[model samples]
Target: MPGREIINLQVGQAGNQVGESFWNALLLEHGLDQSGAYVGTNPLQTARLDVYFTEVAHTNSQSKYVPRSIQVDLEAGVCNRLKSGPLGKLFRPDTYVTGNSGAGNNWAKGFYTEGAELVDALMDATRLQTENADTLQGFQVIHSLGGGTGSGLGSLMLSKLREEYPDRMLATFSVLPSPKVSETVVEPYNAMLSIHQLLDSCDLTVCIDNEALYNITTGMLKIKQPGFSDLNGLISKVMCGVSTSLRFPGQLNGDLRKFCTNLIPFPRLHFLMPSYAPFHDARTQAWQGTSIPELTAALFDRKNLLVACDPRFGRYLTATAIFRGKIASREAEYAVHDLQKRNSHNFVEWIPDNISVSLVSVPPVGQKQAAIALANSTSIQEVFQRSLEGFSAMFKRRAFLHWYTEEGMDVMEFSEAESNTKDLIAEYQQYQEASADVDYEEEQEEQEEEGQAFEEEQQLI
Candidate 1:
């Protein structure tokens, strides 16, 4: 609230069960009252609906297994929007505003053919709202980056928002899929492109890896249930961590005067590492006996390392193994060397040996409400725990390409023949020309040789 300013923007597909759960959890965490929600742009009526969406899904695509529609209310409160049951399910504000269909219409860019004037009106409303809010209370904006909803339409909306407020700081928290199981192909690539566009537009970008968190927490509980619960919990914890970081008496300052003082710099990177319980390999089962060498190979990085655990023995055992293994490895040595090299282009700097290490034990919250409860820790735990929490959060946010060009220096370029989209389309034309040229050359050579042979034979006769 003192110096930080947060603007929240969420976009994506309009309807889905997972979306619903996520929105519900987020609203409860924010302490927003959502009793009366109403759709459309009538702010006068606090009638039982909060979310205001723009697009409505009428004709269902046969290829799609899920159905959804999003409408943006001409007048809808933030609290009202998140409270909407339908809006909670897969509705992403970021995607809805910034996505382009590769064709003509960037519907997600906040302007439809019919609603061309909605752009000016929306900006005016946003400006007014910010002025109304107490500047002392910093803000936060949340949204999704994916295909269909998040990747497509949501990205378009984000672009429009940036145009309106070039100076305002925008912190976007993006959720990334697990590398092992990237079921959604188009979304990943599309989302990456969208993030690349947003990187220049936003101030800070935070990443949340749903897969990594889900895998870790599930292993911790040894539960065989669906992963939706784990995802929700992770989201909650992330949001709570965000809320705590934004507030005073926050987690970043471990030793503080009881009353609180100056603000701490927000985290630069956050990674959410789930437990190493389900060893991707069989070798990690013995915990202590687990090869530190292998772990070092796996986790070593040039950048600063911050490790957090539950402070309990079981969780500590896994966290310690990972840290020790990472601290001792060839990769670690290389990382240190690279850091010391002045001209090194390495992105992650090596950990300094002389620097004093800081440790913070994360406070576990209730099963259902743990995610939101990250805000309730003491100053000591909050600094390390919250900072580490933010550090791990980096893995989840994603940046994508804003524009594509095969001819770029970094991209592999192909000749016309190699670049053909439909091989048949270009192949037939190539063959036709090639065959004609070959026939003409063969005939000319044959005629010349025959004439020479005839002359020689005649002379001999």
Candidate 2:
């Protein structure tokens, strides 16, 4: 069978930038250049580039491969850069869709007015790309929640995709606003609004925190001054790591559907916490050890986690670890078992074997061994709580209310988003405090019933 094709939708400025990094990484892994010419000799590795690339047969034996993705932005600047960049020829001309004006840091304008106007054109581009796929599996959208176009327009795009292709897996790589950082004053409002919509429409949303990225780059990567490119590089690697099973053959191969089924027990609780391991300073990577246990431990470390939340406070319902490189399966299994044994309290007791391991033989372009982890941990609610606090603070004074209101947004929308966010946080709290050991409670009820029967027998005697 042909590979399950995944159509990527990179929305807005941040999305396009991250998308550029992701495609560039893929080019290196598959032994292809910026122009999409397959130059690598590792037939085992480049065999399944079809998962994300479409082939163009030429008169000669050589063929060109173009990515099966579309780039969408409200303004023309970001998309233009991708088109003129080194990898310009790798994407089809129609995949770059942009609007004439910007969203002006207003979520309402992106969702209701400017974004709605451009949605038809972008969806048309998406439809054209999907037609070229043999078995289109689903869509993965990458965008940031702190800005207008990425937050508002990205939310709109997800809802539209859900309406049309309800069966396909709709996953998102959402760069959520950080509690410590404030890019725009209305970021909290925009993020909450996006969360409210995503709770209903998206199948899975991987929450990426900027605060965590800043911490990782400064602390682990040892970068003095981290730019957006530095942060996006990490996100792109995690993106590739998680999809390794889908793109390349693994010991326990899984498609998007299996991945979702394994991690997500309930539909409403699908926001995943992502972490990539084996983070070493570029200068010291050659000296760092790539032991299986070390890589697994790093994945669980809060410092390595992409979200700025403590897993110690929240329980992990389930987690999937994707390990890459030529590692022994037995070693991977023992490493996971030992990690779980040591930190059993952090995982939900109700779920047996919460941690699963998948091994991919093909390593990334640089490293010998690496791993990426996705956990359905309840601690991720902290992200929502931070946004809620910020949103409530601004909403109390009606800060910048006129901008959204003038875009035909109702006053009740704010209230609804606020309420929805609270309920979500409450739900996470409820599960975190839930207990599974019912032996004592059940024994007490049974003894009470037995005593009642004995009294009736005594009366008969």
Candidate 3:
């Protein structure tokens, strides 16, 4: 029986593709071969394999580890490929589900017509996975906001999940649209609508975009023209980094609920900016030497971020640094606190000691050291703002409104999405501008209230 198990639900094409890469990396790190059988000598890796893998024993005590994951799409193409893919044998047959008609890159089509129909089957499959776990932690959904299936249908699934599992923590690896890699004309609408749902439903969302992916692959790694596979590789590595603490034993935090609390300050401000250290091309260089100080600096650098927005423009409400490899506890603690002290302006003054750190003994495969930082900075609102601008521009003209309206969606829904998104953006700005003076004033007001209460009691006596 698995303890603190996380059932993965990868939605749509982008989600499934990224899920493949993510699972492959997990398999390698856990020392499991393609068939999900343990082949590595590291016995410690298998000690906690039950977090994501289910073991079945056969004759001679031979065990097969199947992923506790669900693969779903509105269309059959992506799921079919996964079924025939190299690692297909590792997944259970019942975990894979797909509908015949595609979402057609239209958010309304997926949400109302096609997606609503398949959500029941999706819930049934999810229930099966949860029943198998002795103690289930939560779900980690991977999908993009650019396409219909991922954005529209994905939102539909999220709403239902939140309703069904209200207490469970729901996290998402959400891929946003970018100007550099434009996919669909209606991407703005899809992205905005999805974000509105994410605001209420998701507990924590790690946001990444196509534009940033292109910049990193072309600028840092020196890839000429990075395709979807190359981009997904970067995402998979970061996902691995984020999960390293949960998958293995960590010093401070070792579970989804704990880390989610560490990274999130407010309920609505749970979006994080993910960054990885040592951006080196495998061909040109093996890996960079990592010091706690250097790794910390790299994480704050805009170039190392997986999103287009600059962290310098906004204030950091909170951050979590997960360090993998042989990190000295004393050195890491000193480095993080010292860095925060010297660059006090970079972090919001209202939150005291906002950054949290976690250490993992095992390093990522094929690397000496690695660190991933998830920053809940105000600048992440830039991602939403960009989509809002595009969405407003199109909505003003009533361009391509029929595609959604014909699918039985009301016109007021777009208005609601836009208003909710703007409110979120405003909320971030409110926190970003919070200062030491504001905290001091708030504390003085609290003291005055206490003093008044005491004086009234004395008079009454």
Best by TM-score: 3
Instruction: Select the stronger candidate by TM-score from 1 and 3.
Output: 3
Task: Return the TM-score for each candidate structure.
Answer: 0.42, 0.95, 0.97
Summarize candidate 3's per-residue lDDT along 53-87 as a digit string, tens digits: 99988576878899999998988998899989998
How does candidate 3 score on lDDT? 0.91
Q: Candidate 1 vs candidate 3: which has greater lDDT?
A: 3
Candidate lDDT (C-alpha), each: 0.33, 0.91, 0.91
Which 10 consecutive residues of model 3 have the lowest summed lDDT? Answer: 281-290
User: Which of candidates 1 and 2 reaches a greater lDDT?
Assistant: 2
- Which residue pairs in candidate 2 collide? none
Candidate 2 runs further than 4 Å off: 439-461
lDDT, candidate 2, 143-203, per-residue tens:
9998999989999999999998989999999999986766888999999999999999898
Quickly count the clashes in candidate 1. Answer: 76
Q: After superposition, how far is residue 247 of candidate 3 from its true place, in Å?
A: 0.4
